[model samples]
Target chain A: MIEIRNLTKRFGSLTAVDDVSFDVGRGEVLGFLGPNGAGKSTTMKMVTGFLAPDGGTIRIGGLDVASDPVEVKRWIGYLPEGAPLYGEMTVRAFLRFIAEIRGLRGAEARRRIDSAIEQVSLGTVLEMPIDTLSKGFKRRVGLAQAILHDPHILILDEPTDGLDPNQKHEVRTLIRGMSAEKVIVLSTHILEEVDAVCTRATIIANGRIVSDGTPEELLRRSRMHNALRLGLVVGDAGSAGVVETLKAVPGVALVEVDAQSGNALEVMLFPAGGVPLAGPAGEAARANGWEVTELHVERGRLDDVFRAITVGEGGASHG
Target chain B: MANVWIIYKRELSAYFGTPIAYVFLAIFVFLSGIFAFYIGNFFEREQADLQAFFQFHPWLYLFLIPALSMRLWAEERRAGTIELLFTLPVTMTEVVLGKFLAAWKFTAIALSLTFPFWITVNYLGDPDNGVILAGYLGSLLMAGAFLAIGSCISALTRNQVIAFVVSGVVCLGFVLSGFPLVLDFVGAVAPPIVVDTVRSFSFLTHFQAISKGVLDAGDVIYFVSLIVFWLFVNAVVIEWRKAG
Candidate 1:
């Protein structure tokens, strides 16, 4: 478990991380969402004991970070932003070096190193220097080192930032597979990653967390929740009865007429009390024998919610 | 201490993993030979005591030790590997000490390559071999003192060229402190006691004693304590400014 309270950091006059606090339990994957300069990397550095918090207390596995930093670091594995590695050493040597730093030696160290290499698919590049690897392979090597000692807590900053699409999927799968045992905290601006791998997400902006919840709950923050857009191609038919038919559907509180697209009638259906209009709207279209051509239900969009919360809409930032 | 050992192994191997170790050793060995024989007139002086060889070490180290120590912390800072190192389960002291010891050992290796000089001196004339050994020891200690100052200065900057120039300038002060040129300047205005104090602070005064085979405990303590003091400052500087 990771516990942080009132975590704050300042770089001269700029308050990078302002009074942030959160708790992470075992078997939880917390995705940190933020825009550029949102303090995600700073928070990770503090939790990993790289940077001391100006005002705060951090405890990893019940040991206070300030008092017992080495012990706290022992319980945590961190992949810093950019995965700063010694480019001179080969991949295998670097892993062995980290293993030694983590107090593993001999057979146990070799065994763990092999498994980590296999886990990240870095076996092929073990003999190659880290500087020679591609961006994707370098990221995997960083991941390999982070998971080498198998610490209880894993803090990764942008784990899949420079990887290709297939490599990103592989990393997502790797993260998901380990989600049941370790307390994983990863920072990224990718919205789909939150839905794909993160069980819970926290949105940070202007050095403060604006929202925290499951993906669905965050999506519900969008203005288009429970709104449905249905287009009909009744063959030269205008908005003769489509708007009325959609409005008459049960659980649909409002129906608005939209502009025609290529001789197709478009009508928007708004559900009552945040109920789903997909079922009722689809049923109405079939029952009225309307040649429905296109239909889309807007449960809400995560990106829209992210922009609204981060752009300081409604003054969401506390500082 | 085990953590320190791990970092030591990594940093030591890191030197050889690049072309830097060979290059530094080649240049250091080549220049020391030229300065000791050609510049210092060792061949014409016909002195078997190696005073000619030992006299130029402080000057030699003013340039060379800074080169060895410049990359000790500056490279890590430039490449951003300092973050990875700090995040490990080790303190700043361990990291500082480890890198220092690695650079010190590398310099020692380059210093030991001058054994042919010792062998040649022994073969040429009846020499005080014990005094010659003591001179080698003194030269190595002076190198450590120079390296410690260089390493501390290296921690203040990320650019290696800046690190090298600043460390060289700082180490030069220690090298010139005990010379008559500086002491005469001190003696002209200050009391004799102040002049002696300033002379006592010089690395040359203590190194000269050990190089002559006096082996006084005070001289040994000066070099060892200088190294310790500078390493402590190195740690503090890193801790205070690293997060920034």
Candidate 2:
């Protein structure tokens, strides 16, 4: 588990991370959602003790990072941004160096290194110098180094940055497999990655935590949450006529025309949260004797919420 | 100690991992030979001593040591591996000491590869091996001082070129401090005590005594203390840079 309180860091006059606070517990994959220059990497660096914070305290497993950096480092497996590696070293040699740095030696070191190599599927490139490998392979090699010692926490910055979709899936699966034992914190601008692996998500903007909650909870906060959408097969009279019929239904706060194609009317009805809008709208459409086409309820999407929070909308829905 | 050795082994092996080590050795061997036989006229003098070989060490190290030391911290900073290195469970002092010693030992290995010079001296005449050993010890210690200064300077900038040039200039000053050209300039305005103190700081001043087999404790202490002092400064600079 990791705890950060009012973690403030500034570079010159620019505040890289300002008054950010968050805690990640065991069995949680906390996704740091932010755009570029959002201080995501800076926060990760401070947590890993690579960069000392200008203010605030970070506690890992009850140990203060400033006071006991080496011990705290022993408990962290960090994959820094860009996955910087010793390009001159062969994969096995490079990993052996990390194993030694992590205080493992001999058979145990070999076992862990082999296990890590196998875990990240880096066995094929074990004999090659890291720089000779492709970017994806290099990222995996960096991943292997982070997980080699099996630390209590894993901080991976842009874990799937340059990977193909399949590689991304594999890395997400790997993080999921390790999620049970370690407190995993991975930062990225990829929204789907959060939905795929994060147990809790924190959305950061302008060096501040704008939103923090479970993935589903965040989706529920989206503007599209619970809005009923109806696609009607327009009659002689177009869907402009059915918009009024749907608006007349109870719990329907407002009805607006959505994008229309030939002969079909797409309308979204905003609900006042009093009744089930989808059921009532479907019944009302049947009563109106108009040919109805698509009828569905929106469960909401994270991209909509992300765009909302990042764009400084402050969760302003169609209320 | 274990941390130091771990980093030391890594840093030392890293040098050998590239072609730079071999290139450096080949250049050093070729040049030490040239500077001794051709430049210093070792054959014409034929004094049966390695005076010429040891005489050019300070000059050889002027550019060569900076070449070796330029990448000590600058390359790491440029490649962003400094983040990975700092995140490791090692102190800045340990990293500095480990890297400095690695370069020191590397220069020692380069110095020792001139065993042919020692062997040639032994084969050609009755030479004082003790003086040769003293020369080697002095050269390595002086190399350490140069590496420490280079390491400290390398931490100041992310540009290896700057690191190389600045460190080369500093090492050149350390060597030239005892030269009359430099002494005369300072001797113009300064008193005798100040000028002598400046002269005392030159690598050649202490190296000459050690090369002649005097092995004066003050000269030995000067090189050792210079190495230690610069390494300590190197650590402080790294820490200060990290703070920024």
TM-score of chain B of each: 0.97, 0.97
What lDDT tens digits, residue by residue, belong to model 1 across residues B49-83? 78888888898898989988998988888888899
For residues B5-77, write the lDDT of model 2, one tens digit per residue: 9899989999999999999999999999999999999889887789999999999999999999999998888
Candidate 1, residues A19-84: lDDT per residue as tens digits?
Answer: 999999999999999898889999999999888899989988889989999888888888888888
Error of 1 at B132 (Å): 1.5
lDDT of 2 by residue, A193-294 (tens): 999999999988778898999988998887677888888876666666777777889999889897877777889887886357978888887777767788
- Per DockQ, the best of the predicted structures is 1
- Candidates in order, interface RMSD in Å: 0.8, 1.5
Predicted candidate 1: interface RMSD?
0.8
Chain A TM-scores for all candidates read 0.92, 0.92
Query: Candidates' TM-scores?
Result: 0.95, 0.95
